[model samples]
Target: MRSTTYYAHGLNIKSELFFPEFPLKQTSEIDVIIRFGITNLFNDSSKNFREIYLSKFIQIKITSCNLLYLFWNDIQIFTIKNNEIIINPNTGLDLNYIKFLLFGYGFAILLYLKGRLVLHANAVDMDNSAVVISGVSGIGKSTLSFAFHQKGYKLLCDDVLSINIGKKFQIVYPSFPRIKLWPDVIKNFEEDPEMVPKIHDKTSKRFYNVSGNFSDIKKQIRAIYFIKVTGDIKIKEINPQKAMMELIKSSYCYKLLNHHEISENLSQCSAIVNKVPVKILEVKKSYESLNKLVEIVENDILKN
Candidate 1:
């Protein structure tokens, strides 16, 4: 019983991290097995991880850092690698820590497992389907995501987008459900000062409980808007490859990593480019820019 198994077209996967480099295959024989490294967040860094290899879609990885926790829908599983950690079965998994990881960005890795290689992008729901705004981190992924949320659009996930690639590709995951806003950004959204979550560190964390109906609905991989918050007030489509290149460069599109990582990145990117239409959406640096961009998506691109 293993959490994941990896078999690549070129390399023999020595570690589970290399498994993702291999495209998805349905087989009974396991080439590489990963007994999910699960550990408690409150637990000491020296603690060991619980090893259980089961087949299902999950998004935790064993990299340079320790494995904290993993989410499968609503269920949360905590772990202690190498060491045994028994949590109260009643308490189940820790939601408080999920909020923290959302801020720190553990969800991006999970998005990879589920199918999409998400960058520090942002997304919001419009006319039922979701619209994703992708660009470099400070280019207003969060700011645009929040602005749309204010204008009655449902926030899906920020920073991570789940993409499914094989033949026909699609972005299947909700928008980054939670948002981490700066102190100044918080004041505009919070009517009551006490409504905010507990503050422990310098970063202010805010969690937006996504709707079950919306989360389950895999939003069609509509146009990927490359966000450039320039002083220019313009919203239109540009060359698709040019738009894709911006996301690839900014997100460290690791297709050039190693053969294994490259293979995986290629497998994912090819599907994305072939399936979804990429566009360049440039606007002046303002919250209202998102709305103007949406007008183009709804009127110009998807409508056509």
Candidate 2:
């Protein structure tokens, strides 16, 4: 099969499998390579691997050679070594499901291995700088990002944020131009949920392609917000000390990090808190208040 080149998170990726989510790029220098192959890490007789993470949907193991194995039941298996990812998919498995796994969890782990600070957050370009919004699952992070996109702000990324921490500044790289939304949220946007493509067969979630309003270049981070559902809309700045802890908790694939990576993560988080403003955004749980929330955040960011 002919290979394709794509760019995301500041890396040039050459892959055998097609990734509809990523923007195509023509580059001779490749930072990562992904190919389809049969993975046998689970059946290896050496047994030098140790299981590091286990969840209902996925399991991870690492070998002494630094090879990471990600298993998604019998449907798909991935072996990540160096800058290469080998994917093994079961026969008759839908390509959409494979793409979902490769782009989400698989790519997050790959970014972590490459020594990038990854956050489980939604990022948007606000006034030439990046602003991040993070919260627990189903807490409207993507919804808020969509609101920003609708208001003429360019979206940087959704779900996984990759950052390059410098001595005095941190830059956030754009990850594709896609946002996942629930069926009801689609309806709130005056769009037919059934008309949109589902993220996976197991869920009613749909993805919106926003390539037209995507910020493809990297941007300096201006602020970070940890949101919660509250009775009213309020935005309070967090101190550096407390903000560091919150950033650590919001890291992507944090549970899978080893001790050394955890220490590095702590140092990186500290740097981020000191350089950018971190705040607590209290928002009501009603979609009707989305505009108000966006206005409040925009004003707050502008004032700083």
Candidate 3:
């Protein structure tokens, strides 16, 4: 099989399978490899693995040898060892869904192993710096980030944001050039939702490719916003102490981290809060307010 190289999240990924979600890059260095293969972790008799996290739809296990196994219901099994991800899929799974999982959760795990802080957020480049918008699921993070994209601001990432914390600066790496949106959000943007590709057969969410509007370069993080649905629009900076807690809560795959990683996460979050401004943004829960929301955020960014 011919392998392809792609760049995202500050890493050169080489994979045998083609991933349209990521941008193709020409590079000799391979930071991560993705391939298809059978995973026998569940059948291993040695049983050296410990279950790290389990939910109704997914189960995560880690072996004593440092291999990570992720089983998503009956759909797929991902075995991550070192810099390689081996995927084993069950019958009748959609390739789009597989790519969705690989690009999101699988890559997130890889970033975690590489000691980067991964957040469940969307980011846009503002004045050559990155601004992150995060919240609980279905909180319009992607929609707002797309609004910024519409305003000529380049999108750094959507759904997953990775950061490298240095002594003097926190740099955020761009993810793939894709954003997921609900059907209504697409209609609000005056595009037919049915024309876009569905993220999965079971969901109405669609994937919007923003290759022309993507920022592939890494940038220093300017600020982080935690948004809420409220009656009015407001933005207020949060103190470092409280910001640290919000960062922890917004961490991707927080329950899967070990004790050492948890300690490191705490230290990194503290560092980020001390160096970067964290704020709470409250906005009305209506699509009509999107333009106003964007105006308020841009003004806030300009003022700070």
Listing every candidate in turn, what is its Cα RMSD in Å to the true structure after a full C-alpha superposition?
11.2, 1.7, 1.6
| Residue lDDT tens for model 2, 21-122 | 899999899999998888787576557977755467688888767788887774447888759998885536677877787777888888988888988898
Colliding pairs, model 2: none
- Clash totals in order: 19, 0, 0
Q: How many backbone clashes does candidate 3 have?
A: 0
Query: Which model scores highest in lDDT?
Result: 2
Ranking by lDDT: 2, 3, 1
Question: What TM-score would each prediction reach against the true structure?
Answer: 0.60, 0.95, 0.95
Computed on alpha carbons, the lDDT of every model, listed in order, comes to 0.50, 0.87, 0.86
Candidate 1: tens digits of C-alpha lDDT, residues 235-303: 666665675566566443242133575567765665677677677677777654557755665675556
* Candidate 3 lDDT score relative to the true structure: 0.86
lDDT of 3 by residue, 143-208 (tens): 999888888999999888889999999999999888999988889888898898898887888999
lDDT of 2 at 44: 65
Span of 10 residues, lowest total lDDT, candidate 3: 89-98
Off-target runs (Cα >4 Å) in candidate 2 are: 42-46, 74-76
TM match of model 1 to true structure: 0.60
What is candidate 2's TM-score against the reference?
A: 0.95
